[model samples]
Target chain A: MRATTIHAPGDIRVSEVPDPTITAPTDAIVKVTAGCICGSDLWPYRGENPITEGDTIGHECVGVVEEVGSEVHSFKPGDFVVVPFCHSDNTCAHCLHGAHSVCTNLGMTVSGQAEYALVTQAEGSLVKLDEMPDASMIPSLLALSDVMPTGWHAAVCAGVPEGGTVVVVGDGAVGLCGVLAASVMGAEKVIVMSRHEPRQRIATAFGATHVVAARGREGAAEVKEITDGVGADAVLECVGTDAAMGTAFAVARPGSMVGFVGVPHGVQLPVQKMFQKNVGLRGGMAPVRRYLPELLDLVTSGSIEPGLVFDSTLPLDQVADGYRAMDERRAIKVMLDLQG
Target chain B: MRATTIHAPGDIRVSEVPDPTITAPTDAIVKVTAGCICGSDLWPYRGENPITEGDTIGHECVGVVEEVGSEVHSFKPGDFVVVPFCHSDNTCAHCLHGAHSVCTNLGMTVSGQAEYALVTQAEGSLVKLDEMPDASMIPSLLALSDVMPTGWHAAVCAGVPEGGTVVVVGDGAVGLCGVLAASVMGAEKVIVMSRHEPRQRIATAFGATHVVAARGREGAAEVKEITDGVGADAVLECVGTDAAMGTAFAVARPGSMVGFVGVPHGVQLPVQKMFQKNVGLRGGMAPVRRYLPELLDLVTSGSIEPGLVFDSTLPLDQVADGYRAMDERRAIKVMLDLQG
Candidate 1:
C-alpha cells in the first residue's frame, strides 16, 4: 500500500508502506476513498513539529470499510463511512458527553492519508452513510471527517445566537466552512476576516455578509465600525496564531464568547482583558463524530457545499503535489483521489 | 460623613469625608446600614494593591435610600436596598445580556465602606427589599450585595449539571458560599479545598460533602482521588492566585468547565493544557445585580444563610479594626455597623 510519509521537514513523499490490518478486536480496516492535507499537517511540514521515522501522516478521510475485527458490530466490509479524525469507544465519560476528540479510550487516531488505514474502536468512530454517495459528492462527505465539523463546532461553541452577528477569523477551508455554519445556524450577519480575493469569494459564496481585509488592531477596528462599535455577538477563531486570537478577542462584544478550533501553538490568552470584558472562551478539538450525522444530512440535502473548499484534486500517487499546493497556499484544500 | 479611607497601602482609617450627594439624575444617596470587608479589599490593605490618599475602600454594602435624584424611580428615601458591588444601568447591551459587571453606560462604582455611599444608576443597581428585616438577617441580606451572588455566578457559569460533582477552590467566604450555591443547584457532592478549621466548619455547614485541606498539586490530586480520577464535573475558582487557578484547571473533568469569579491579577492561563483537556473556562466579575432578585428571594425564604460568613461586627468608627481582622484572616468577614 502507498501512503504519505514525512521523512523530514518539507519532505513529503508517497511511498510504499505495509498495509494496515485489523490488530484489535474492535479494529477495522478502511480502504481510503479520499483524503486531504490539513492545516495542522503544515506544522510538521514546516518543521515546527518534529517528525520521526515511520510516522504516518493524515488524520482526515472518508472511506469504505474493507474488513472488521470480531468485536466491530457497527460496520461491515464495503460499508461507506465518514472516519472521524479521532477514534473513541463512544462509551467513555468524555465520549458520552460529546467530547470524542479527547476520548479516554482510543484518544486521537492518525494514519488516514493512505490506501489502507487501520481504524480502532470502529463501532464508535465510523459514521456509516445510508448509501454510497455520488462520486462528485465525495469531497463534501469527506469534509465531515474533520474540517466541516470543526468549523461547525466553532460556531456552536461561540454561542452564535439566532439572527446575531458572527466574525470568522481565518480564510482557510475551515474558516470558509465556519461562514457556512454560521449562516446555516441563523446568524443574520457573518463577517469573514480574509485578505485574499479568492478566499474572500469563497467566503461570500459560503454566506459571509462582509469581509475585512485588515489585520490585527486594524481588522478589529473594521469589525467594530461595521457593528456600530459594539463588536460581533460571537467570534470564531479558525486560525490559532496569537495575532488571530488577539483579533478574535478584540472584535468580540463584551459578554460574548470567542470559540477557537485551530490547534494552538505558542498562544497566550490575555486573561485580564478577557476577564474585564466578561468574554468567555470555549473551543478545542471539535467533537467531529457528534456532528458528522447532522452535517452528512446537510450535505445530502444540498443545503451546504463544503466540497467547494477543495480547489484541486489529485491521484493518490500525486499526494506530494497536493501537499505542496496547500503548503504554498495555491489551494484552499487539496483532495487526494484514492481510487487509483 | 465618616468613611473608611486608605491613605496609603496598609494605612486604613475612619476619616471625615465629604457627604455623598446625588450627582447624576440616575444617582441616589444611601445611608449605609451595614458594610463588610471583602477578600479583594485585603489586596489593598495587605499592600499588594497600592492605595492612594482619600481612596474609599469597600465595594459591598446594604443600606437605606436616603435621597434619590429625579430619574431614580426605583427607590425613594427610607427604602431598604442591596447595593450590588458593581453599578450598572441594566439597559446597555452587556447588561441586557446579563453581564451587568461590564455595563456600558455605568462602569464599576466603588465607595461602599462609609457611613453614606453614593449609588449611581439607582434604578438598575438597587435591589429593594420588601421590608426592613430583623437585625439578625441584615448580615445575610448584605451577603447578596457581592459574595453570595459572586459564588452563585461561578456555579451557574460553570454549568453545574444536576447531581454532578463540584469542587470549590478557596475557603474564603465566597468559596463557602459557592458550596451552598452548588448544593442548592442540585450538585450531589460538593468538595471544598480549605486548610482552615473554622472555614472547613463553615464549608461543611454550607453543604460541602468533602473537604480537601491541601493546596496546589496535592489539592488537585485529592479532588481527583475523591472523584475516582474522572475529576469534578464542575470547579468553582474563588481564589485569583496562579496556584488556585492551576488547581482549578487540574481538577476539572475533560469537556467540563471551570468558572472563576475572583478578580484575576497576574494570572496567565495555560491555554495549551486547557485546550488539550477540552476544559472550558468562563466567569469574570459576577453579574451581581442580575442574580440579586433570585438570591434575595432565597434569603427571604430562609433557604440559604450566606450571611453567616460575617463572623465579626464593628461600629462605623472601628472600620480600621474590620479591615485588620479580615486582612489578618481573624474573621471570615467583618460587618461594619454604620448606624452606631
Candidate 2:
C-alpha cells in the first residue's frame, strides 16, 4: 500500500509500505477515499515536534470499510465510514462520560494518509453514513474525522451562547470551522482574527461579522470595541502559541471561557487575570468521536460547507507538495485524493 | 465610632475611627448586628498579604439599615439586610451578565467590622429581609454575605450535574459551605479533604459523604480510590495554594470542571495535563451579590445552617482576639457581636 511518511523535518514522501491488517477483534481496515493534513502535522514538519526517522502521518480520513474483526459490531465491509482522529471504545468510562479523546481504550487511526487505514475500536469511533453520497461530499465528510468536530469542540467548550458574540483567534481550517460552528450555534456576531484575505473571505462566508487583522492587544481591542467594550461572550483559541493564548484571554469578558484546541507549547496561563475577571480555560484534543455524528448530519444536509477550507488538493502521490503548501501558508489545508 | 483596623501584619486593633456617613446617592449606613472573620481576612493577619499601618478591614456583615442615600430604593432605613463582600450596582454590563463581582460600579464594603458600616450600591448590593429574624439567625445571615455565596459560585462554575460526585479541596468555612452547595445541587457523593477532626465534623454535617485527610498527591489518590479509579465528577478548589490547585486537578475526571474560589497565589496551572485530560478550570472571586437571594432564602428557611461554620463568637472590642484566634486556626470562623 502506498502511504505518506515523514523522514524528517521538511522531508515528506509517498512510497509503498506494508499493508495494515486487522490485528485485534475490535479493529477494521478501511480503503481511504480521502485524507487531509492538519495544522498539528506542521509541528513535526517544521521540527517543532520531535519525530522518528520515518513514521506514517495523517489522522483525518473518510473511507469505505474493507474488512472488520469478529468483535466489531457497528461497522462492516463495504460500509462508508468517517474515522475519528482518535479511536475509542464508547463503553469505556471516559467515553461514556463524553471524554472519548481520553477513552480507556483510546488510540489514533493508523496509516490514515495511505491507500488503506486500520481503525481500532471501530464499533465506537467510526460513524457510518446511512447511504453513499455524491463524490463531491467526500471532502466535507472527511473533515468530520478531525477539523469540523474539533472546531465544534472549541465552540462547545467556549460555551457560545445563542445571540452572543464569539471571537475565533486563528485563521486555520479549524478556526474557520469554529466560526461556522458559532454561527450554527446562533452567535449573533462572529469575529475572526485573520490577516489573510482568502481566509478572511472564508471566515465571512462562515458567518464572521467582523475581521481584525491586528495582532496581540490591538486585535483584542478591536474585538472589545465590536462587543461594545464587554469583550467576546466566548473565545475559540485555535492557535496554541503563547501570543494566541494571550490574545484569547485578552478578548474574553468576565464569566466567559476560552476554549483552546491547539496543542499548547511554552504558553503561560494568565492565572491572576483569569482569577480576577472570572474567565475560564477549557479545551484540548477534541473528542471527535463524540461530536462526529451531529456534525456529519449538518454537513450532509448542506447547512455548512466546511470543505471550503480545503483550498488546495492533490493526488496522494504528491503528498510532499501538499505538506509544502500547508507549511508555507500557501494553502489553508490540503486534501489528498487517495482514489486518484 | 469604633472599628477593626489592621496596624500591620499580625497586628489588629479595635479603636476610635471617624464614623462613616453616606457619601454617594447609592450609599447606605448599616448598624451592624453581626460581622464575621473570613479566611481571606487571615491573609493580612498572617503577613502573607501586605497591609497598610491602619486600614479598616472586614467585608462580611449583616445589619439593620440605619440610613440610606437619596438614590437608594430597594433597601429602607429599618430593613435588616445582608451586605455582600463586594458591592455591585447589579445593573452594569457585568452584573447583568451574572458577573457582579466585576461590575462597572463595583466596590468593597466599608468598615464592616464596626458598629456602623457603609454599603455602596445599596439598592443593588443589599438584600432586605422580609422581617428581622431572631438573634440566632444573625450569624447565618452574615455567612451569606461571603462564604456561602462564594461556595455556591464554586459549585455553579464547576457545572455540578445532578447525582454527580463532588470533591471539595479545602475544609475551611467556605469549603464546608461548598459541601452544602454541592449536596444542594444534587451531587450524590460529596468528599472533603480535611485533616482536622473539628472541620471534618462540620463538613459531614454540611452533607459531606466522605472525608480524605491526606494532602497533595496522597489526598488525590484517596479521592480516586473512593471514586473507583475514576476522579470526582466535579471539584471545588477552595484553597488557592499550589498544592490545593494540584490536588483539585489531580482528582478530577476527564471532561470534569474544577471550580476554584480561593485567591490563587504562587500556583501554576497544569495546562498540559488539563488539556490531555479534557479537564477544565473555571472560577475566581465569586459574584456574591448575584447569588445572594437564593442563598439567603435557604438560610432563612432553615433548609441550610451555614452559620454552623461560626464556631467562635466575640464582642466588637475583642476584634484583636478574633484575628489571633483565626490566624492560629483556633476557630473555623469568628462572629463578632457588633451590637453586644
Candidate 3:
C-alpha cells in the first residue's frame, strides 16, 4: 500500500506503507476511493505542531469496505461508505446523545490519504451510501466525511434558524461550506467575509447573499451595516485566530450565536464583551459524525454540492502537488483520486 | 434631595443633589422607599473601576411613583413599584424580543442611590406590586429590582433543568440568590463553590446540596467527582473573574450550558475547551424587567426570601460606611434607610 507521510515541515511524500488489517473485533479494512488535504493537516505540515519521523496523515475519506472483523454486524464486504474523521463505539452514552465526536471510546484508526486504511468501531464510523456513487460524486461524498459535516456542525451548534442572518468568518473550505450549511438550514441571509475571489464565488454559489472582503473591526462593521446595524443573528467562525474570534464577537447581534470550528491559535474569548453583547459561543472539534446522515441525504438529493470547493484534483501518487497548490492558496481544496 | 456619590476610590458620601424631574416624555419621578448596595458597586468603590468625580451610584430600588410624564400610561402617581436597573423603553425591537437590558432607548438612566430617581420609560421600567408592602417587606421587594432577577437570569440562561446538577461559580449576593433561583427552577442538585463561610451558609440555606471550597481546576475536579465524572449539567458563573469563568467551563458536562451574570472583569473564555466540551455560554446584563413580575409573585406569596442577602443596614448619612463594609467584605449587601 502507499500513503502520504510527513517527515518534516513543508515535506510530504507518497511512500510505501504496510496494508491495514483487522486488529480489533470491531475493526474493518477499507480501500480508499478518494481523499483530500484538510485545513487541519496544514497544522503539522507547517511544523507548528509536533510531528514524528514518519507519521501517516489524513482523516477524511470515502472508501469501500474490503473486509470486516467478527464483531462488525451492520457492514459487509464491498459496500461503498463515507467515514467520519472520528471513530466512536456508537453505543456509548455520549454517542446515544448524538455527540459522536466526544464518544467515550474514540479513536483515529483511518488515515484518509492512503490506498487502504483500518477503521475501528466500524458500525459507528462508516455511513454506507444507499447506492454506488458515480466517480463525479466521489469528492462531494468524501466531503461529507469531514468538511460538510463540520460546516453543518458549526451552523447547528450556533442554532442557525430559518430567516436568520448568518455570518461566516473564514474563507477556507470549511468556512465556505458553512455558508452552504446555513443556507440549507434556512438562513435568509448568508454573509461570507473573505478577500479571496475564488472562495467568495463558491460561497455565493452556495447561497451567500452578501460577501465582505474586510477583516477585523472593519469587517464586523460591514456585517453590521448589511444587517441594518443589528449585527448577524448567527456567526460561524472557521478561522481560529484572535482576529477571527474578535470579528465573531463584534458582528453578532444581542442574543445571537457564534459557532467556532477552527482549532484555536492563541485566541481567547472576550468574556466581558460576550456578556455585554449577550452573544452565545458554542464550538470545538465539530462532531461531524452527528450530521453525516442528513448531510449525505442532502448531497445525494442534489440540494447542495460541497465538492465545488475542490478546485484541484490529483492522483494518489501526486498528493504532494495537492498540498503545494493549497499551501500556495491556488486551490480552495485538493482532491486525491485513490481509485486510480 | 440627597444621594450617595463616589468622588474617588474609597470615598463615598451622602450629599444634597437636585431632585429628579421627568426629562423625557416617557419618564417618571419615584420617591424611593428602599435601595440596596450591589456587589457590582464594590467595583468602583474598591478602585477596580474608575470613579470620576462625584458620580451617583446604586441600581436597585423599590419606590412610590411621585410623578409621571405625559407619555407614561402604565404607571401613575402614588403607585408602589419595583424599578429595574436598566431603564428600557420596552417598545423597541430588542425590548420586544425580551432583551430589555440592551433596549434601544433609555438604557442608561442610573439614579438608584437618591431619594428620588428619574426613571425613563416609566411604563416599562416600573412593575407595580399588587399591593403596598409593610416596612419589613421593603428589603425583599427592593431585591426584586436587581439581585434576585439577575440570579434568576443566570440560572435560566444556564438552562438548568429539573433533576439536573448545577454548579454556581460565585458566592456574592447574586450567587447566593442564584442558589434560590436554581432551587425554584427545580434543579435537583445545587452545588455552590465558595470558601467564604458567610456566603456558604447563605447558599446552604437557599438549598445548595453540595458545597466545594476549591476554585479553578481543583474546584472543577471536585465538581466532576461529585457528578460521577460527568460534570454538572449547568453552571452559573455569578462571579466575574477569569478563575471563576475557567471553573464554570471545567465543571460542566458536554452539551450543557453555562450562564454567566458576573460583569466580566478581565475574564477570557477558553474557546477550544468550551467547543470540545460542547458547552453553551449565554449571559450578560440581565433583563431584570423581564423577570421582576414573576419574582414579585414568588415574593408576595411568601415562597422565597431573597432579602436575606442583605447582612447589614445603614442610614443614608452613613453611606460611606455601607460602601466600606461591602468593599471590605464585611457585608454581602447593605440596605440604606433614606429617611435617617
Candidate 4:
C-alpha cells in the first residue's frame, strides 16, 4: 500500500508502506476513498511540529470498510463512511456527553492518508453513508470527516444565536466553512476577515454578508463599524496565532462569545481585557464526531456544499503538490483522489 | 455625611465627606442601610491595587432611597434597594443582553461604603426590595449587592448541569457563596477547596459535599480522586491568582467549563494545555445587576443565606477596623452598620 510519509520537515512523499489490518476486536480495516491535507498538517510541513521517524500523515478521510473485527457491530465490509478524526469508544463518560474528541479509550490508530488504514473503535468513529456517494460528492463528503464538522463545532460552541451577527477570522478552508456554518446556523450578518481576493470570493459565496480586508485593530474596527460599533455577536477564530486570538476578542461584543478552533500557538489570553469585555471564550479540538451525522444529512440533502473549500485536487502520487499548494496559500484545501 | 476613604495603600479612615446628591437625571441618592468590605477591597488595602488619594472604597451595599432625580422613576424616597456593584443605564446594548456590568452609559458614582451614596443609572443598578425587612435580613440582603451575585454568576456561566459534580476554587466569602449557588442550581456534589477551618465549616454549611484541604496540584488530585479519576463537570474559579486558575483548569474534565469571577491578576492562560484538554473558559466581572432579581428572591424566600459570609460587623466610624480585620484574614467579610 502507498501512504503519505513525512521523513523530515517539508519532505512529504507517497511511498510504499505496509497495509493496515484489523488488530483489536473493535477495529476495522478501511480502504481510503479520498483524503486531504489539513491545516494541522502544515504544522509539521513547516517544521513547527517535528516529524517522528517515518510518521504517516493525515487525519481526515472518506473511506469504505473492507474488513471488520469480531466486535465491530455498527459497520460491515463495503460500507462507505465518513471517518471521524478522533476515535472513541462511544461509551466513555466523555463520549456519552457527545465529547468524542476527548474519548477516554482513544488509542493509537493508522493514518488515513493511505490506501488502507486501520480504524479503531469503528462503531463510534465511522458514520456510514446510505450508499456510495457520486464522485462529485466525494470531496464534500470527505469534508464531513473533519473540516465541515469542525466549522460547525465552532459555530455551536460560540453560541451563535439565531439571527445574530457572526465574525469569522482567517481565510483558510476551515474559516470559509465557518462562514457557511454561521449562515446555516441562522446568523443574520456573516462577516469574513480576509486579505486575499480569491478567499474573499469563496467567503462571499459561502454567505458572508461583509468582508474586511484589514488585519488586527483595523479589522476589529471594520467589524465594529459593520455591527453599529457594538462588535459581533459571535466571533469564530480559525487561526491560532496570538494576533488572530486578540482580534477575535476585540471584535466580539460584550456578552458575546469568541469560539476559537485553531490549534493555539503562543497565544496568551489578555485576562483583564477579556474580563472587562465579558466575552466568553470556548473552543478546542472541536467535537467533530458529534456533528458528523447532522452535517452528513445537510450534505446528502444538498443543503450545503462544504466541498467548495477544496480549490485543488490531486492524485495520490502527486501528494507533495497538494502540500505545496496549501503551504503556499494557492489552495484553500487540497483533496486527494486515493483511487487514482 | 461620613465615608470610608483610602489616603494611601493600608491607610483607611472613616471621616466626614460631602453629602451625595442626585447629579444626573438618572441618578438617585441612597442612604446606606448596610454595607460590607469585599475581598476585592483588600486588593487596595494590601497595596496590590493602588489607592488614589482620598478614594472612597466600597461597591457593595443595601440601602434606602433618600432622593431621586427627575428621570429616576424606578423608586422614590424610603424605598429599600440592593445597589449592584456596577452602575449601568439598563438601556445599553450590553445591558439589554443581560450584561449590565459593562453598560455603555456607565458613569462615576459614590462608593456604597459612604453614609449617603449617589447611585448612577438608578433604574438599572438598583433592585428595590418589597419593603424593609427584619434586622437579621440586612446582612443577607447586603450580600446580594455583590458577593452573592458574583458567586451565582460563576456557577451560571460555568453551565453547571443538574446533578453534575462541581468544584469551587477558593474558600473566601465568594467561594462559600459559590457552593450555595451550585447546590441551589442542582449540582449533586459540590466540592469546595479550602484549608482554613472557619472557611471549611462555612463551605459545608453552604452545601459543600466535600472539602479538599490541599492547594495546587494536590488539591486537583484530591478532586480527581473524589470524582473517580474523572474531573468535576464544572469548576467555579473564585480566586484570581495563577495557582488557583491552574488548579481550576486541572480539576475540570475535558469538555467541561471553568467559570472565573475573581478579578484576574497576573494570570496567563496555558493555551496549549487548555486546547488539548478541550476545556472551555468563560468568565469575567460578574453581571451582578442581572442576577440580583433572582438572587434577591432566593434570599427573601430563605432558600439561601449568602449573608452568612459576613463574619464580622462594625459601625461606620470603625470602618478602619473592618478593613483591618478583612486584610488580616480575621473575617471572611465585614459588615458596616451605618446607623451605628
Candidate 5:
C-alpha cells in the first residue's frame, strides 16, 4: 500500500507501506478513496513541529470499508464511509456533551492518506453513507472528515447569529470553509480577511460579502471601518498565529466572541482587550466527530459544496507533490486520489 | 459633604469636600442612605492599583434622589434608587445588547459614600425603587449596585445550567454573591473555594452545597474528588488572581466555560490549557445596570439576602475604618451608614 511519509522538513514522499490490519476488537480497515492535505499538516512539513523520519501522516479520509473486527457492528465490508480525524466512543461524558475531541476513549485516525487505513472505535469514528456515491460526491464527503466540521465548530463557538455580521480571519482551506459555515448559518455579512486572490475567490463563492486584503493593523482598521466602528458581531479566527489572533480580537464587537479553530503556535491572547470588550474566546480541537453526522447530511443533500475548497487533485503516487503544492500555497487544498 | 478619599495604599480618610453640582444635563444628585465597600476597592486601599492622592472613592450605594438635571427623567427627587457603579445611557448599541458597561457614554459613580453623590446618565445608571423601604432593606439594595450584579455576570457567562454543578473560585463578597446567583439559577451543587470560616458561613447561607477549604492544587484535587473526577459543569472565577483562574480552569468540565468578573490584574490566562480542555473563557466587567431590575425585584421580593455579606456596619465618618477592616480581612464587607 502506498502511503504519505515525512523524512524531514521539505521532504514528503509516497512510499510502499504495509497494508493496515484490524488491531483491536473495535477496529476496521478502510481502503481510502480520497484524502486531502490540511493547513495543519504544514507545521511538520515546515519543520515548525518535530516529526520522525518515515512516519506515516494524514488524518482525513473517505473510503470503502475493507474489513472489520468482530466488535465493529456499525460498519462492514464494501460500505462507503467518512472518517473523523480523531475517533471516539461518542458515549463518554465529554462526547455526550458534543465534545468528542475530549472523549474518554479517544483515538487518532492516522496514516489516512494511504491505500489502507486502520480505524479504531469504528462505529463511533466512521460515518456510513446511505449509499455508494459517484466520484463527484467523494470530495465533499471527504471534507466532512475534518475541515468542514472544524469550520463549523468555529462558527458555533462564535455564536454567529442569524442576520448578524461575522469576520473570518485567515483564508486557508479551513478559513474558506468557515466562510461557507457562516453563510449556511445565515450570517448577513461574512467579512473575510485575505490577502491572496485565489483564496478570496473561494471565499466569495462560499458566501463572503466583503474581503479585507490588508494584513495586520491596517486590516483590522479596514474591518472596523466596514463595520462602522462597531466591530464585527462575531469573529472566526482560522489562523493560529499571533497576528491573526490580534486581528480577530481587534475586530470583535462588544459582547461578541472569537471562535478560534487554528492550532495556536506561540499565540499570546490579548486577555485584557477581551475582558474590556466583553469578547469571549472559545474553541480548541474541534469536536469534528460529533458534528460529522449533520455536516455529512448537508454535503450529501447538496445544500453545501465544501469540496470546492480542493483546488488541486492528484494520484496517490503524487502525494509528495500535494504536500509541496499546499506548502507553497499554490493549492488551497490538495486532494490525493488514493484509489489510483 | 464628606466622602471617602484614598491618599495612599494604607491611608483612607473621610474629609470635607465641595458638594457636587449638575455638571451635565444627564446628571442627578442622590442623598445616600447606604453605601458599602467592595472587594475591588481594597485593590487601591492595599496599593495594588494606582490611586491619586485624595481621590474620591466608593461605587456602591442605595440612596434617595436629591436632585436631577433637566434631562434626567427616569429618576426624580424623593424616589429611592440603586445606582450602578458605572453610568451609561442604556440606549447605546452596546447597552441595547444588555452590555451597559460598554455603553458609548459610560461614566463612573465616584464619591458614592458621601452624603450626596452626583450620577451621570441618570436615566440609564439609576434604577428607582417603587417606594422607599425601611433601614433593613438598605444594605441589600446597596449590594445590587455592584456585588450582586457582578456575581450574576459570572454565573451568566459561565452558562450555569439548571441542576448542573457550579464552582466559585473566590470567597469574597462577590464570590459569596456568586454562590447566591448559582443557587437562584437552579444549580444542584454550588461549591465555594473558601478557607475563611466566616466567608464559608455566608457561602452556605447563599446556597453552597459544598465548601472546599483547601486552596491551590489541593483545592482542585478536592473538587475533582467531589465531582467524581468529572469536574464542575460551570466555573465562576470571582477572584482575579492567576491562582484563582488556575483553579477555575483546573476543575472545569470539558465543554464548560469559566465566567470571570474579578478585574484582572497581571493575570496571564492559560490559553493552551483552555484550548486543550474545550473550556471557554467569557466575561469581564459586569453590566450591573442591565441586571439591576431583575436583581432589584429578587431582593425587594425577599427571595435573596445578599446583604448578609456585610459583616460590619460603620457610620459615614468612619469610612477609613471600613476600608481598614476590609483591608485586614476583619470584615467580609463594610457598610457606610451615610444617613447617620
Candidate 6:
C-alpha cells in the first residue's frame, strides 16, 4: 500500500507503507475510497505543529469496511461509510452528549488520508450510508466525512439563528461552507469576510448577504457599520489566527456567540474584553460525527452542494500537487480520488 | 445627598454631594435603603484597576424610589426596589435577548454606595418586591442586588445540571453563593476550593459536597480524582484572578462549561488548550436584572436565604469602615444601613 508521509516541514512524499490492520477488538479495517487534504493537516505539514517523520496524515474520508474485529458492531463487510475525524466508543458520557470530537477513546483507530486505515470503536465512529452512494454523490459524501459537518458545527456553536446577522471569518472551504450552513439555519444575513475575489463570489453564491474584505479591527468595524453599531449576532471564527480570533471577538454583540473551528495557532483569548461584553466562546474540532446525518440529508436533497468547495481534484498519487496548490492559494480544497 | 467616593487606592470617604435629579426621561431618583461592597469593588480599591480620584464608587443597592421621571412607568415614589448594577432601557434587541448587562441605552451607571442612587431605565433595571420587607430580609435582598445573582449566573453559565459535579473557584461571597446556587440548581456534588475556615464552613453550609484547599494544577488534579478523572461537569470561576481562571480551565472536563463572573484581572485565556479541550467560557457581571425576579421569588417564598454572605454590617456614617473591613479581609461582605 502507498501512503503520504511527512518527513519534515515541506517534505511530504508518497511512499510504500505496510497496510493497517485491526490492533484492537473495537477496530475495523477500512479501504479508503476517497480522501482529501484538510486545512488542519496543513498545520503539521507546514511544521507549525510538531509532526514525527513518516506519521500518517489524514483524518477525513469515505471508505468501505473491508473487515471488522469481534467487538465491532453496527458495521459489516462491503458497507460504505463516512468516518468521523475523532474515534469514540459512542457510549461515554461525552459521546452520548454529542461531543464526539473530545471522545475519551480517541486512539488512532482509522485515518482517512491512507489507502488502508484501522478504525477504532468501529460501531461508534462509522456512519454507514443507507446504501452505497452513487458516483455523483462521492464528493458530497466525502465532505460529510469532515468539512460540511465541521462548517455546520461552527454555525451551530455560534448560535446563528433565523434572521440573525452572522459573520464568517475566513475564505477557506470550511468558512465558505459555514456561510451555507448559516443560510440553511435561517440566518437572514450571512457575511463572509474575504479579500479574494473568486472566494468572495463563491461566498455570495453560498448565501452570504454581504462580504467585507477588511481584516482585524477594520473588519469588525465594517461588520458593526452594517449591523447599525450592534455588531454581529454571531461570529464564526473559521481561521485560527490571532487576528481572526480578535476580529471574531470584536464583531460579536454582547450575549452573542463566537464559534471557533480553526485549529488555534498561538491565539490568546481576550478574556477581559469578552467578559465585559458578555460574549461567549464555544467551539473546537468539528463534531462531524454528530452532524453528518443532517448535512448528508441536505446534500442528498439538493438544497446545497458543499462539494463545490473542491475547486480541483487529483488522483491519490498526485497528492503532492494538491498540497502545493492549496499552500499556494490556487485551490480552495483539493479532493483526492483513492479509487482512481 | 451623600456618596461614597474613592480618593485613592486605599481611601474611600463618604462625602456630601449634590442630590441627583432625573437626567433622562427614563431615570428615577431612589433614596438608598441599603448598599453593599462587591468583590469587583476591590479591583480599584486594591489598586489593581485604575480609577480617577474622587470617582463615585459602588454598583449594588436596594432603595426606595424618591422621585420618578415622566417616562418611568414601573417605578414610583416610595416604592422599595432592588436596582440592577447595569441600567438598561430593556427595549433594545440585546435587552430583549436578555443581555441587560450590555443594554445599549445606559452608559455604565454606578454610584450605589450612597445616600441616594439614580437609576436610569427604571422600568427595566429596578425590581420591586411585593411589599416592604422586614429588616431581617434586607441583607438577602441586598445580595440580590449583585452577589447572589452573579453567583447564580456563574453556575447557570457553566451549565450545571442535575446530579452533575460543579467546582467553584473563588471563596468570596460570590463563590460562597455559587455553592448555594449549585445546590439549589440540583447539582449533587458542589466542590469549593477554599482555604479560609469561615468561607469553607459557609460553603459547606451552602451545600458544597467537597472542599479542596490547594490551588492550580494540584487543585485540578484533586477535583479530577473526585470525579473519577473526568473532572467537573461545570466550573464556576468567581474570583477574577489568573490563578482562579487557571483552576477553572484545569478542572473542567473536556466539552464542559466554565462560567466566570469575577471581573477579569490579568487573566488570559489560552485558546490553544481551550480549543483542544472543547471547553466553553461564558459569564460577565451577572445579568442580575434578568435573574432578580426568580431569586426574589425564592427569597419571598423562604426557600433560600442568601444573606449569610453578609458577615458584618455598619451604619451609613461608618461606610469607610465597611470598605476597610472588606479590604482587610476582616469581613466577607459589609452591609451599610441607611436609616442608622
Scored by CA lDDT, what does every candidate get?
A: 0.89, 0.92, 0.86, 0.88, 0.91, 0.86
In lDDT terms, which candidate is top? 2
* Model 3 segments more than 4 A misplaced: none
Q: Judging by DockQ, tell me the better candidate of 3 and 6.
A: 6
Each candidate's TM vs. the true structure?
A: 0.98, 0.98, 0.95, 0.98, 0.99, 0.95
lDDT of 1 by residue, A205-273 (tens): 999999999998898999999998888999999989998899999999987889889989889998888
What pairs collide in candidate 6?
Answer: A109-A118, A109-A119, A109-A120
DockQ of 2: 0.84
**DockQ, 0 to 1 scale, candidate 1:** 0.76
Error of 1 at B268 (Å): 1.5
Give the per-residue lDDT of model 6 (tens digit) for A253-295. 8888899898888888888788888899989987677787787
lDDT of 1 by residue, B127-192 (tens): 887788888889999999999999999998788888999999999999999999999999999999
Clashes of 4: 0
Number of the candidate with higher DockQ, 4 or 6: 4
How well is each residue in A1-340 modelled by candidate 5, as lDDT tens digits? 8888889998988888888887799899998999888899999999999999998999999899999999888888999999999898888888988888988888887788888888888887888987898899888998998999989999999999999999999999899999999999999999999989999999999999999999888998999899888888989999999989999999998888999999999999787887888889999988988888789889888999999999999998888888888888888999988766
What is the alpha-carbon interface RMSD for each candidate? 1.0, 0.5, 1.5, 1.0, 0.8, 1.2
Candidate with maximal DockQ: 2
| Candidate 3 DockQ, CA atoms | 0.64
On TM-score, the stronger of 5 and 6 is 5
Docking class of 1: medium
Candidate 3, residue B291: Cα displacement in angstroms equals 2.6
Q: Provide the global lDDT of candidate 1 against the true structure.
A: 0.89
Enumerate clash totals for all models, in the order shown: 0, 0, 1, 0, 0, 3
Model 1 regions lying over 4 Å from their true place: none
Question: What is every candidate's C-alpha DockQ against the true complex, given to 2 decimals?
Answer: 0.76, 0.84, 0.64, 0.81, 0.78, 0.73
Q: Write the per-residue lDDT of candidate 2 for residues A1-340, one digit (tens) a residue.
A: 9999999999999978899988999999999999999999999999999988779999999999999999997787889999999999999889999999999998897588889999988998999998886898988998899998888999999999999999999999999999999999999999999999999999999999999999988888898899999999999999899899999999999999999998998889989999999999999999998888788889999998899999988999888999999988999999999887
Which residue pairs collide, candidate 2? Answer: none
**Candidates' chain A TM-scores:** 0.98, 0.99, 0.98, 0.98, 0.98, 0.96
